[model samples]
Target: MNFNIEPISTQIEEALQQKIDTKTKPLGSLGKLETIALKIGKIQDTLSPALNKPAILVCAADHGITQEGISPFPQEVTFQMVMNFLGGGAAINVFTQQNNIELVLADTGVNFDFEKHPSLLDYKIAKGTKNFASEAAMTIAQCEQAMQNGAAITEKLHANGTNIIGFGEMGIGNTTAAAALLTAYTNIDAKDAAGAGTGLDEKGIAHKAEVIAKAIAKQGIPNSPLEILATYGGFEIATICGAMLKAAELKMIVMVDGFIVTAAFLAASKINVTIADYALFCHKSNEKGHALMLDHLNAEPILDLGMRLGEGTGNAVAYPVIKSAVQFLNNMSSFADAGVATEK
Candidate 1:
């Protein structure tokens, strides 16, 4: 999929930083908040940036790789958890509601048919992706369709006045897919990228690693990121990847959730490297390989609460801090405005 994502113009960085440094608080006292404010300023290309209609798009799907017994949770949980999200019972639901962020659920490719929910977007791509361990997860056409669906939904949200979008996902056996995609994007070893997804034990982690390795060997990664995504990414991941690309193109501040979402970010960045200009690495997941992946991008997460729940909880939980960043930038008085003298 093609996106005209441009780099955030840095022409105003000096002025933005000056505005931040002149705050009544000691220079750099706000630390990352200062950095976040400057980024928002550069992204909107304005000194006064306001977050409007913040939202989290949670894409739910299932993975046929569960056939290999990769996750402790049954594949049916994908359907169940999407139900929880719709019924306002999931952790993501709780966090988004508490933070007053709009929760947008999409049935990207769950195996089971869902009853029509007013909130869930119907963009299911087939029943779900095929078994990547034994075959391609999705055809190139399916992958393209998934990305198009994602970009379309994001555009709709943008049209609706949403300017801050975060991505979340629910899918059994997707961490393995993420591991495979991580390896494809960064050449990280499967053994290292593999993790204890859904509470996999030491033995299960090793087995998951083996399956990732086998899948890579059997279906050799293609040259293009899209082909690699089709070979290994789940419907939800490709959807989120597409959404992120569009969010950057629309100049929205993108909040990246846990490991799985970050893998999608990796794909979006590979497609358009400038997309990183609009992203805030929301949190560092406690899951194995996530830290390594974040380090690969030199990303300093806004929070590290040892969370690996994956359903965009990180974004919802950390958004207040993001708002705080913007709040201080907009509300805090400058030294001169406060009539406070600084030492020479």
Candidate 2:
């Protein structure tokens, strides 16, 4: 389908200058907002960037490695957490509602069977992926299907006029899986990428790293992101990666969530460099490897409230700043129009 990165337009730069001049504050007074508005304007290729019909798509799945005791939470937590999201009790739900964002929960690979939960979108690939510690986590076909699911979801959201989309994940032990994927993709030591997922203890963290190292050593590094993803990635991570790419193709602003979602974005960016331009990093997560990962990607997070809870919390919390960026650009009037003296 010729997925290529679109270049920022000069019109966006000109519009940004005009918009900033219109605000009560001096031009470029709002440092980050100016940058953000310009970036958004460039992304939408419009002088007027509007974040209409914003949606947070949370992909949920269960990691087979949860059985290995890598995470403090149980695998069942994946479905339970999805239920929590459906119940509108999650941090994501609260923030999404506050921001008037539509929330979508996709069952990518959660193990439990759900009986038609109205709020839940049933796109389950399987009960869950197989154990990667012993073998490949998902087959190539499974990986492809997950990607398609993600693309379809993004396409649906885009068709519904979703201008800004946030990516979140719900899965037990996903950070462990994401860390392992990062270690393999970046060729760093798994120990360095490992984190205290769901509050793992020292011993548990060590064991998790050891297990990841062993798995990576056995599988060997793959030639591409697809192969690597098929080998170690949870369905939720894989889906998020696909969503990032699709969002970029559709020219939508992609707000990345915490560590795992960032990892997914990294994987997608590796496959396509233009993906980085479309992504707005939400925050630097408290996950152990998130800061280093962000540094490696050369990404500046929009906020740093020390958020660690996944489920798109960072993206949701950072919505106000995004809203302000759009609001300032669209609603503010120019100095000449306001009869204000321009500081020459």
Candidate 3:
């Protein structure tokens, strides 16, 4: 469980800024792109930073909360969507293919078993988490296993020279778990954290909120990240937390997806605050609690396409923008190199 993530040093910030400012453009005109370039440079600890073998890891699982009828989609949909991801039919598949980002799928804890597939990593920790309404979502052992598996996956990718990763998840009723985690981490009311996930209607969302509230009351407020995750997190969430921490430890660019992925990062940040240093929030999801969650982290997302669908689609969609940021920093000519007159 020891991530060993270290804070990114600020020693290079000034130098990075100088290099960016010398670009043949009005200072700060590039806005957030400039910020992203600086961040990538800081992460790589170099003036010239490159994204290598960028890939998106979509971890799918089932939630015990799904049995409580939180989502309009059936629990079977979780496994079905995993199949879609494998079949290259999901939105994430389309976007990743469109952008040429490698797609990695993991069965962290889906309810169904599958035949061996080359693209799917079989790291199933359990069929699914236990119902938090009646018991802890996952035993401590399961939580640790899921996290370790996630970290191991990232380590393998890093070994393969993959320096940038996007984290995403699939789980029926996962929003309930995310709401519970958000409430625990930010003290946001369960009602506010609850959202219309997977086409939940108003009544379903209200019921979801009540379910989360009861789970919180039963579990009491968790004192630590591990405790919170064990109490309310889905297998995919725990795994993403581990992946994110390991990515930071390896100084990889972590492109975080929407609400559920962000919730995992919230827990990871609590465990090791430096994880945020390696993360680039890809977009502000249209999910109700997402904006609040982003505000909680003081994160500014690069896109606002009103996207709420998961499966790492947001990360894949935003990859070009992120790449552009790094490209302009490393490839754009400086005023001196371009023979452009500096403002007097």
Supply candidate 2's per-residue lDDT for 140: 84
* Shift in Å, residue 41, candidate 1: 0.6
TM-scores, all models, native as reference: 0.99, 0.95, 0.98
Q: Over the stretch 179-298, how does candidate 2's per-residue lDDT look in tens digits?
A: 988898788788889989899888989999999999988888899888898888989988888888888988899999889999888888887878888888888899998987898889
Which of candidates 1 and 3 reaches a greater lDDT?
1
Clashes of each: 0, 0, 0
Best-to-worst ranking by TM-score:
1, 3, 2
- Candidate 3 lDDT tens digits, 171-210: 9988889889999888899999999988888898899999
lDDT of each: 0.93, 0.86, 0.92
**Candidate 1: tens digits of C-alpha lDDT, residues 1-344:** 79998889899999999999999988899999999999999999999999999999999999888898889998899998898888899999899989999999999999998878798889999888899988999999999899999999999999999999999999999998898899888989999999998999999999999999888989987999999999999999999999999999999999999999999998888888999999999999998989988988778999999999999999999999999999998999999999999787
- Look at candidate 3 and give me any clashing residue pairs: none
